[model samples]
Target: MAAAKIKKGDSVVVRSGKDKGRTGTVLQVMPKEGKVVVSGVNIAARHRKPTQVNPQGGIDRREAPLAISKIGLAVDGKPSRVRFETKDGKKVRVAVKSGETIDG
Candidate 1:
């Protein structure tokens, strides 16, 4: 997979869709699909059958994967675009809005 602009654990904001303006932490990144699963965003209900873990399986709510283009990285407590830059011999993500280094 190509290098990911956003990584797991990074805070992000939804730009569009039903969850627009909502913010959440990155839970998983699917580079191949260009999608991400953020906490508390794009939630969906899934019906489950009885299993060893839960005999009374019913409906379960969980976050669903969203297109990466629909979200932006949160920097300085706000949503902003990100760019890659070389800093001290290492590559890092930088926030365009605040000109701040995203990954420390």
Candidate 2:
């Protein structure tokens, strides 16, 4: 599998989906599956059975994983393209707009 340009904690914008143009921080990355879970995006409700952790389990709202290709990195509060480069000895992915490395 190709290395994902986006990683956990990186801010991203939904590119093409029902949640298009929405921006959120990446909560998790499933590199093997080529998907990512973004905060407050692609939310889904699940009927949960009452458990010890949640005695009043009812509707559980959670972020659903979206395909990585559906998201674009957010730079300067706007969706921007990214490119990978090696600055010094470290390989870094930099935002095309500001040329700043996206924090992992």
Candidate 3:
């Protein structure tokens, strides 16, 4: 699997697609599939079958995964590039703008 720069809870901005320019937190990451689910982004409706527990069948709103390449990390509310760096013998990722390493 390829290494992923963004992780869960990281803030990101949609670089392209219908949600372009929208910013949201990263809810999940799928490195193998090169997809990431951002909170409040790529929402889709799902039809549910009524079960004994629910009696009423309804549509539910859910988040859908989008290609990782379509999103960009947001640093200090600004879209910036990211790079991996080594500090004190440990590899860490940092935002290019502030040069602050993002803790894992």
lDDT per residue as tens, model 1, 13-97: 9989899999999999999999999999999999999999999999999999999999999876678988999999999999999
Arranged by lDDT, best first: 1, 2, 3
lDDT, candidate 2, 5-98, per-residue tens: 8878888998898999999999999999999999999999999999999999899899999999899899877888788898787888989989
lDDT string for model 3 (1-104, tens) is: 65788889999999889988899999999999999999999999999999998789899999999999998899777777688988888888888878877774
- Clash count (model 2, backbone only): 0
| TM-score of every candidate | 0.88, 0.84, 0.87
Candidate 3 segments exceeding 4 Å error: none
RMSD list, candidates in order = 1.8, 2.3, 1.7
What is the C-alpha local distance difference test score of each model?
Answer: 0.92, 0.89, 0.89
Instruction: Looking at model 2, report the run of 10 residues with the lowest lDDT sum.
Output: 95-104
In terms of lDDT, the best-performing candidate is 1
CA lDDT for candidate 3:
0.89
